[model samples]
Target: MALHVSLIDFLSVIPRLYPNDPDYFCSLCLLSTSSLCPECQHTHSTHSCPIGGLCDTHRFHIHCLFNLYVMLNMP
Candidate 1:
């Protein structure tokens, strides 16, 4: 079954990614990439998600996979 994401989660990504009106989203249709929160011990990536290292296992879309990589690498 396909997972469902809410508008609030999608809306939250715009500020982190586009920071504007998300004009880029119009072109790509789907721009953000999602990942599970690191604090969760799930074997699969989608089982837990969103930022702040939540254990809630709620999937939320962030800007892109690149953002995830960037977040992971930061000091």
Candidate 2:
């Protein structure tokens, strides 16, 4: 028997290693050297917003994140 992988699984597991757009700065509050979120006290080096890819370029407090999703018409 052979193991099989789904397309969705492959897509989901791959991280966005390279920044695609220059307009979109790192959402994480980067450290002076490395990409890091100062808000999280640099605990999480990259802060991909919970809003999925829509607001990945923007970082917010928990409340702000919720409001932004609503404003942007994202579920």
User: Judged by lDDT against the true structure, how good is candidate 1?
Assistant: 0.36
**After best superposition, candidate 2 residue 4: deviation in angstroms?**
33
Per-residue lDDT tens digits for candidate 2, residues 1-75, read 323444455335424632445455554433322233334323232345332222244333443434433444533
Please state the error at residue 1 of candidate 1 in Å: 7.1
lDDT for position 21 in model 1: 45
lDDT of 1 by residue, 1-75 (tens): 323444456446644653334233322224323243222323234424424311222223333433444554555
In model 2, the clashing pairs are none
The whole-model lDDT of each prediction reads 0.36, 0.38
- TM-scores of all models? 0.22, 0.24
Best by TM-score: 2
Count of steric clashes across candidates, in order: 0, 0
User: RMSDs, each prediction?
Assistant: 13.2, 12.2
